[model samples]
Target: MTRSFSWWAALGRTLLCLVFLQSLLGKMGGFGAVAAQMQQRGLPIPAVVLAVSMALMAVGSVLVISGWRQRLGAALLLVFLVPATLVFHTALEDPQERIQLFKNLAIMGGLLLVIDREAPSDRPVRR
Candidate 1:
């Protein structure tokens, strides 16, 4: 890849992982609060879910940033994002919640692009 393409791709991947990294940090600092929020959402095994979510976010962010198993990372983020959007941001009656839902959707769109992009190993030989 050319230098420009490499730079842009790295920037894009970093930006995409930013939200997950920030969220994982926040969740780490307030595990109880996150678990409580999960419980309030009527989710079962709140603690387990919280732990798993954190793990996915951390691992997914690393994978995306390192450009290794990036599609798997994006998939993991989707697995986390889908239910999060439904459970936390589905209150269309509230404007803020509606915006949050759209924000999550946009993030998912970015992730889909990342997932669809060809990995180095998947690229065919040019010569």
Candidate 2:
């Protein structure tokens, strides 16, 4: 790859992880609020789930930004996003909620692209 391409790729990776990195502060500082939100949604073991999700986001963001095990990082984000989108943004009656749902979906799509672009060796072998 050209030097410019390398620089752009690094920038893109950092930008992709920005959301997760920014969220870490809110998640860490407002742990009780996040847990309460999950509990209100009727999710089981809200505190444990919130903790695990925060950990995954933290680790995944680091991996993605550093371009080490990026596919795993993207996969972890995707896993967290899928359920989060469904559980938190399912209120079709509220326009704001609908918008948030689509935003999450778009983020999921980007992560999917990241996962798909992984190196061939990073992918599982076909039978």
Best by lDDT: 1
**Candidate 1 local lDDT, 1-127, one digit each (tens):** 5223487888899999999999999999999998998998899999999999998899888988888788899999999999889889989999999999999999999999989997557789898
TM-score of 1: 0.89
Clashes of each: 0, 0
Deviation from native of the Cα of residue 89 in model 1, angstroms: 0.6
- Error (Å) of candidate 1 at residue 123 is 5.5
What TM-score would each prediction reach against the true structure?
Answer: 0.89, 0.86
Worst 10-residue stretch by lDDT in candidate 1?
1-10
Candidate 2 lDDT over 1-127, as tens digits, reads 2222367767887888788878888999999998998899899999999989988899888887777778899999988889988888999999999999988888888788878875655567789
- Tell me how candidate 1 scores on lDDT: 0.90
Error of 1 at 11 (Å): 0.8
